[model samples]
Target: MHRRASPGSQDHFDLFPYIAILMSLLGALLTATLGMASLSLGPGVAETWDMAARDGTASKAPVLVEWDGSALTVHEGAQRRRVPWLDDQAAAAGGMRPRSAAMQRLLAEFGQRSATGYVLFAVRPSGFATLPRLTDDFRAAHIDIGYEPVGQERGVQLLSAGEHP
Candidate 1:
């Protein structure tokens, strides 16, 4: 009978060992090409540079509010007060409900009669899903809330820092 080869006679290869090295090489090439392309393109526009309405919104600052998942806070000129933005904490929590007394009072302070009314919400990325609830709650009270719908970075920075919107 012919002698059979042992179980360890053949070597096994693991593709995973080379994956990182291959990826690193490809990524370096791609990154270098992108860098050269951007440099050739010159400085077009900065990511944070906004040249839209400068002083048109200076008449009055938009009403700003910050939501932190479980709590809501209103921003005045320089003061920030927590308000009860939810009618119930558990049942239908994110559902649109009547404003609480504290929230009503807070709104009453910034309440205005502009042709276009709005309430700015400085919300975290995590709170983005609940934004509809916040807007619905405000609109339910007859206050038109206008949001940028994009560039949430600036809003997050200003509103989260308690700055006047």
Candidate 2:
């Protein structure tokens, strides 16, 4: 025959299970409070470099270029150079395009050489026109593309492909 515990003994045994349940509830409550606090206290997210604009104007950012020079050099506090094809086009056609294959190749080489932040391309309006395709191509090759306008002209829109003004 089973014998029931005395009242004092039963009370003592019940205290442990009550304490365990209390502790579990407290732990769960603490975890949920911490999670909510974190959600409310985190800093705002930063915008992508390509989406950055300043003072109602598109700012010029640094870009890496591969020139004919022997050693890597940082010009104007950042490395930038004119490719051979760009030079040839400037000489022959009196104008150069920044979105050409040569420029892309230079950008690729620069990206491979540096461990710095994203590469910025100082492009003209014409160059900006080709940016969407270039960005796509770069992404396909696993490269990130960021761009900025170079000249002082205002009211120019640098839209990616399929972007509406």
Candidate 3:
């Protein structure tokens, strides 16, 4: 049937209300998503981002920091060596030093071996708690450190040069 819309009469049902309702629902959903995103960006998050941004130097080798349930270790290239911590019972009670003697030795070794000035540090789950101080220590030695978190299954992830931190 060909029914024309008259001057003061309707030929079909008005869909404006339906469109308005859909728009309202979409607006509500958008509002919720934005609110959640804002909540996630806490004060600490911004500070951490700023800190990461400060280390803007391009990195080289990917070094993973690992903890084998007993000791802290480092995996660089194919070498997985134990980083012997000092006898500081209180710092970690678990006997893990944030800045270890073996680490200093490793730094010397890197100085002799690698030609690159930066190294990205990937931390194992067990070693994450000890990472902050260790990263700071590496920075103190003029080595750039970028964060890379290895999964539970992968003990150490050695990212290649083409890959990232």
Counting clashing residue pairs in each candidate, in order, gives 0, 0, 0
List model 3 lDDT by residue over 1-165, tens digit each: 998877788466899999999999999999999999988864434111111233556444445555533355676567877766444554668654554566678767655544554555555676677677666666666665577666545544555444454
Which residue pairs overlap in candidate 2's backbone?
none
- The C-alpha RMSD of each candidate to the native structure, in angstroms, is 11.9, 16.2, 11.1
Ranking by lDDT: 1, 3, 2
lDDT of all predictions: 0.60, 0.48, 0.59
> lDDT tens digits, residues 3-108, model 2?
9888767543348888999999999999999999888755542222233453545333334321222211123332344443333445477675434556557557
Candidate 2 stretches with Cα past 4 Å from truth are 1-80, 84-107, 113-115, 152-165
Model 1 lowest lDDT segment of ten: 44-53
Tens digits of per-residue lDDT for model 1, 25-119: 99999999999989975654222212124554544335656675545666664677788765674347666666566767755654554344456
- Count steric clashes of candidate 1: 0
Query: Which has the higher lDDT value, candidate number 1 or candidate number 2?
Result: 1
Per TM-score, the best of the predicted structures is: 1
Clashes of 2: 0
Error of 1 at 134 (Å): 1.7
Error of 2 at 57 (Å): 26
